[model samples]
Target chain A: MWRPLAEAARELIDLCVMSDVDEDEVRAARADVEAAVARLRKVRRTQTLGQQHLTGGRRRPWGNPVIGLRNPIAPPLQVSTDPSGRAATEFHCGPAYEGPPGLVHGGVVSLLLDQLLGHAVGAAGRPGMTGTLTIVYRQGTPLGDLRAEAWIDREDGIKTWAKARMIGPDGVTAEAEGVFILPRAIRERSPSSPTGHIG
Target chain B: MWRPLAEAARELIDLCVMSDVDEDEVRAARADVEAAVARLRKVRRTQTLGQQHLTGGRRRPWGNPVIGLRNPIAPPLQVSTDPSGRAATEFHCGPAYEGPPGLVHGGVVSLLLDQLLGHAVGAAGRPGMTGTLTIVYRQGTPLGDLRAEAWIDREDGIKTWAKARMIGPDGVTAEAEGVFILPRAIRERSPSSPTGHIG
Candidate 1:
């Protein structure tokens, strides 16, 4: 149901950034866009507000902008879990994500790495919020198909450390390490099982 | 000229992510959007493509997405330079940037910090590409108005080290350090001068 809307929205976003329309044409376009917004507002009035946060471990493929199926900001991600517990996703950065001419935005690369690391932690049964993240850009990430992989490095108490890397067509474009913190509520529920050190 | 276009595009992006219309309404909206896109395409065919990278020493307030004047993804950044050469910008995050329940996306915070540090380095007479960035999230950054400050920590050869912090209404939300690499072209121009250390 949402797939088509997401595709359309993505196209719209791409046009907005890359197009070079003149003022009069842009004004005309704006009027059309305003009309569409009004119609959308009318439909929105009938639905209740959505839950603000993810809950219950129910996978939300469409909840995050980084991997969300219904988010135009997201590059299409195809994720798979390895039997050994690593998480990997194959995706692409198109012209809409352009930063330095042909290169991907540095922030967008960070976002992908953050999501990959978080997903790796969750795949290992220890999902948490990001506490710290460090990234090293080895080379400019070109706007094209790419692959990313992440795995848990280790764990200490309530924190899980994970590492991830993004691979462009040539080679490694960026690498990252992130610290994720398990919330207190979840920590309390799993006490005595093992509070520290995950291999 | 570009201002109004950016404004319109931003509105389009916000509506794309936040709107919750049904399939039929989405289809209708898509038609209107398509018309706008067609018009934009017509205009784009008549103009030359823009320069692919930043050049000269001209300051482009609308260059980077984190603080670009015409970028909807950007928070409105009103920057002021201090007498001591530190750079500061005051801005706000809206619902469109939401990641956690009421908090800003961690990546968004990182983007802001990256820009702040880069801006500070540029303000200090050394601008370059990001080599590395490390961010520590002390607390969840709530979505609303905030302040960010960045300044040069030191310099080594062609590398500039900088630090920045994001302050929310409560207190400090996130802090970061980054290393930026000055290109060889710029480095060669200033080789005769002292190439190490900065207060």
Candidate 2:
């Protein structure tokens, strides 16, 4: 049911990212999109904020811009968690994500690291909003199949630290460390909470 | 000219971000987009890489993802340079950029800061690629009008250091420091060059 909608959205994003149409075609396409938006806006007014997950919820994919299966901005990422609770994913970045001539955008690299690190922390039973993130770019990440891995580094009270790296065909292209904070509401609810919600 | 193309692209992105359509509607809209893409692909084959800027080039608007006037992913940013060479921009983050509930996404903040800090370095006559970016999130940045500023902190040989901050309605929301490196090609071309091309 939702798969087709996501696929269509991905097609739309691809067109927007690299399409080169003339003025007449662009105007025509723009009008079509505007009409769709007007119709959709009517439906949105009837819906409310979706559900929030605390812990052990259904293992449904999210709509995150970086790793969400339903997000067109994301590449097709296939993530898995090992028994030891490390999270890893493999995917390919296409021309739509290009920043430099042949390299993936640096911000996109950060986005992937943030999502991977967050997932690693969540798998370790601690999830929170990003408090700080530091990214180091070792080399240009080319647009192609790549691998990423992340794991928990340490945990201190309400903060959890994690590190992740992106590997290109050559070698490590970027690395990151992040501190995620458990919200006050969650902390007040469970003093010894190991699993929490992620933002 | 390019304006209409950019405007159309922005419109397409907006629809992709928030539009809610049923399965049948998605299929119809997807077909429309696919046809447009077929025409646009032909047009793209005729185009080449656009222009590049060295030092003191005309301050023309670019299509950058974070601050480009033609980029829909960007919040509306109005920037100006001060006498001391600081770059400041004021803008608003809408729901389209939300990550956490009622707050702007951390990566969005980093993207804006990266662009702002990069612009500050370029304005100071040392455009280069981002080597490292370290961001500290002081608080959850609420979604609304905000202000950001960046400027050169120091420089050594081929490295330029810059700092930037994002302020929400309350106070400081996030801050960042980055080290940008002038490529060897640029450094070798001008032994003491303060400005180079940005990748």
Candidate 3:
């Protein structure tokens, strides 16, 4: 995937050199690359398979909540939602993901926290932004098979308190706590995404 | 800097193809690449200068801390100890770091947060592993002249709290909050890094 981008960059550099552009042009080219990448920030929400993870949950589920991945494609390892408060995604990590020997990169784990906690804020039936997120990595996590979950703990007007985690093959590997902020832009419902008790 | 590593990888693959060592050597060469990467991670820690930042008051610092990059050879950043219960850094986000039009990538913002916050934990004069760090993108951040600061917010025996931020040309572009766990190595010094007073 990065190969095509590298090829494009090389071509752009070639074009810059051929045209004898100034340093300002080089700076402009860098902006062009980032502008191109910014487009990927938008996330596409999938139709709910109608499948649900929470089913009359006083019983509670297995493992710890602090460290887990929700959907595999959930890059940003985080979550995204419309106004309904339901978030979705899929993600994967490979060799580049490793941190300490067999351990996954700690920074990547935080990346997931930002992604999922942001989702939880949206799940609280509000379209908002992230105010804060805190995570705890309890132990080394081996690669592969991650689970994620998020829910609102509290909400006050624009502030939504939420939590999420990535449970690895070794069980609860890391967890997070956050405050999601619903900015004024779309704080109210879209009429399309109705409110509900969220996870 | 990456040229030598790339060349070494190419040479190893070529050598295995030309010699009669067997297919196992190809596997060995791949392992070599992995080992090389591990070495890079080990050396990665030696890069920081000032360790982290602090507020000393109950109030969260009104704005993001502007950290200074003290080490000339630091890899875009470095961490060093500050006796007042704080840590700081200075780094340059070059062409390799862009995620938005003329701005640094969001992930990079979080990366700086993790590093600064770790130093914040270190500021307590105790070395604990990270449990969580949450980042909020307040506004778009440009790629150059980035400053970061981190400091202890509150602390108990096993749990410590801290906050961080990435400041750039535009202003305070990001804010972060973290919870860190003291590994026994540093937890033992808990008596020194109290919540109300700066170290």
Candidate 4:
């Protein structure tokens, strides 16, 4: 139900950033967008929490800004795990995700790596929250089709160390190392539990 | 002109996530949003790059995802420098920015810190691109009124090290340390030049 709306909203965002419309046209578009907002606000979700679990056993958060299906801000990356136990995704960004000139936002890259690392750790049968994330940008991530991959580096007690990298047309652009830790609550309750609060 | 559209887009996003509208209502809203996108796409910007400098000498990027007035994905943070040369902003995140149940997304925190560190380094008369960023999540950042601050820790040749933190109601939820470096192109041109590409 929401996938179409989110897709349309993403289109609207890209147009908003990359278009050269005049103020008169801008006003017209704004009016239409406002009408949509008004109509949607007629009903509010009293229970927005725990809605992700209700999505038929899927772990995807529909409103995540990086990979949420219902989120317009996300490139809505479709990540898949290889047989070798590595998570990977190939995605594209338009002008809406621009940081400098013609380049993807550095923070956007961080957001992608964070999500990819989370997926890698979760694929390892140990879901955890992000404790420490370190990113090294080797070159500017251009705004276009890009590839990213992540794998578990090691595990230390309650912590899981992971590594990931973003590849642009020019090979490696950025690399990340993260330490994800099981929340104390989940660890205290059941150390072997795969379900826990994750970022 | 894009401000109103971006603002309305943000409102629509919040409503999309936090609302309980039915399929019929969702369809109605989707149509309106599609109309807006169609209208806005009638014209395309021939030159989208380097448009930031056209904004009346202001350093702000109108389409920036973290603090862009024309970017809806941003909480659209307005950062200010204090008398002590620290960068700070007080902002709020709605349901659109949620990650873990009721807390702000961890990557969203990283985005804010990245932009704050950029502002801090720029404020110190040393504009550069992000080299490395490290974030430590001490606690979950809540989804409401929050505060963040950044300052230059030191400068080593063409590299500037900075520190920042996000403060929720419970105290500091996350701390970030970033290393910003003058790009090789800019460094070769003039090591003392303040005008250069930044993250």
Using DockQ as the measure, the top candidate is: 4
lDDT of 3: 0.47
Q: Whose TM-score is higher: candidate 1's or candidate 2's?
A: 1
CA lDDT, candidate 1, residue A6:
62
* Per-model DockQ against the true two-chain complex: 0.39, 0.37, 0.08, 0.70
The C-alpha stretches of model 4 lying farther than 4 A from their native spots are A49-60, A82-85, A184-193, B49-59, B82-84, B184-193
Model 1 TM-score (2 dp) = 0.85
> What tens digits encode model 2's per-residue C-alpha lDDT throughout B118-151?
7787777777778998889898888779999999
lDDT of 1 by residue, B86-157 (tens): 889888775556566566768778877876776677667686768899999999888778899988898898
TM-score of chain B of each: 0.81, 0.76, 0.57, 0.90
Error of 3 at A6 (Å): 8.1
Per-residue alpha-carbon lDDT of model 3 for A23-127, expressed as tens digits? 444344334333332322232212111111223322111111111121111122334454534454444443223333334456657655655665556455553
Q: Give residue B30's lDDT in candidate 2 (0 to 100).
A: 57
lDDT of 4 at A40: 91
Cα error, residue B130 of model 2, in Å, equals 1.4
Off by over 4 Å in 1: A43-50, A53-63, A190-199, B43-63, B76-78, B82-85, B190-199
Q: What is the alpha-carbon interface RMSD for each candidate?
A: 4.5, 3.5, 17.2, 1.6
TM-score of each model, paired residue for residue: 0.85, 0.83, 0.51, 0.93
Which residue pairs come into collision in candidate 4?
Answer: none
DockQ for the candidate 2 complex?
0.37
Task: Indicate the worst ten consecutive residues by lDDT in candidate 2 chain B.
Answer: B45-54
